[model samples]
Target: MGRWAVATERRRGEALIRAIHEAVLAEVVDAGLGQLTMEGIARRAATAKTVLYRRWATPFELLIDALGEAYPVEVPTPAADNLRTDLIAALTLLTDWMVTPAATAVMAITSERGRYPELAEALWDKVFDPRGGTFTTTVLRWYAARGRLDPARLTPITTQIGEALVFKLAIDNARTPSAEEVAAIVDEALLPALGL
Candidate 1:
């Protein structure tokens, strides 16, 4: 193909790949990850099964891709004020994020992938790291700017808060992380992380 023709075809191919990803996400969201299959995804995406198999080797692989598509890091940055307030807002955002249907399912999937370190690593590298890292980076930044941040204080606070929120949601089956609880995390963990 000519240069222009090649570029056009490449773009079209990229669009098709994205469409297939979307179709898989829709299927998983509608029917859960177990319902996802190569043939099923091919039929839903109006593509060939072989094509999907080439892109992904297993249902889990495909599920991870779908999860990545659905749970991309789109959380907004919190407005600044002081460490406590900014972090509280950040933790609040994290709270809402955990309960999102996509995030919740992804967490469950990650938990299940405990045996497959490679898959778990991929999930963390692509999805979990970005989300968690953003918050960590944000907290650090907040402290750096204020010149009052302390890691000793901030670490425990954020850790406790995050652990509590996650444990409560996963084990306790809570719907939302309370504002008061988020504040506690910021006050406790986030403070020491800076300098306290």
Candidate 2:
């Protein structure tokens, strides 16, 4: 028999992108931002470097794109009547996402933002900003628009309360907050600030 090359099925469309995203996140979490590279991601993803290049010019660009895709969006109650429940759910989403590889990669980028200012900027611009700014911002806005929350109270600081507390507790405790802790944050901290 003549020697022949073996062919394997290739990932395409959303599946391919999802694999690439997961690879980049794992790369950043495992190797850190300084060590992230197209070669590294492609190797982790089991794809060709040419495949990554076909979509992104730099490793950071691909990383940003991946982060944007992995980032979560909060879904508040449609009627906007359950502010506390919705806020708890919003903060719960944050806590849930905190344990993911993508969230770990985000922490890596943010912790080293001073060293990688451009990367941090891209994270904010490309990922967080486009995704409703913060965890509770969307829910808060939803309530305010429905007249459940006062619009004037939805300042930057107020909108950040849930996310800030969640991050602070995570940093201090060395773990993501639990469901009760998430609810406490909304009740004890966020609601008071919003004048609930």
Candidate 3:
């Protein structure tokens, strides 16, 4: 292909991907994940079904990508000078996202993981862990830098305690955790576990 043809193809590919993403979000919101299909998304996005097939082997893959884009979480570096306060702030961001429509959709999609094993792995690999890692990794390293992180509790599971609590509350209680509850999770559970 010529240089101009290659550039044009790249631009069109970008536009098609964007359109597919938007179409997936619309399909999820309108029809729910169970009902989403490549044909429907292609029609919604005004693109060829072959285009989607070329990129994603299944609707689950497309759904994961769409969820990643639709529910972009901002991981804030908490600078509260103490693990408790910093963790509370960081955990609050996750707690807040837990109650959003996007999260609800994610929960719905994940619940069907029994049917689509790949969806379960993709949701964690593409959507949750990547965003969750940003906060957990940053906070752990920040505390470690100050020689505050307990060497025994320096694993991924330990870093996830606060967000895990928030997720549990969101799932079990069907409500966003209160500020006090968020703080309590950080201070009472996570801090103690971390030996902080």
lDDT of each: 0.61, 0.92, 0.74
Alpha-carbon RMSD of each model = 6.4, 2.7, 5.9
Error of 2 at 140 (Å): 0.5
Cα lDDT of model 3 by residue, 131-181, tens digit: 645445566667776667755677878877777788788778878889999
Residue by residue across 122-163, what tens digits does model 1's lDDT show?
777876566555444456545555655544454445544544
Candidate number achieving the greatest lDDT relative to the actual structure: 2
The model with the greatest TM-score is 2
Residue 50, model 1, lDDT: 82
lDDT of 1 at 111: 67
Better of 2 and 3 by TM-score: 2
Which prediction has more favorable TM-score, 1 or 3?
3
Clashes per candidate, residues 3 or more apart or on different chains: 25, 0, 0
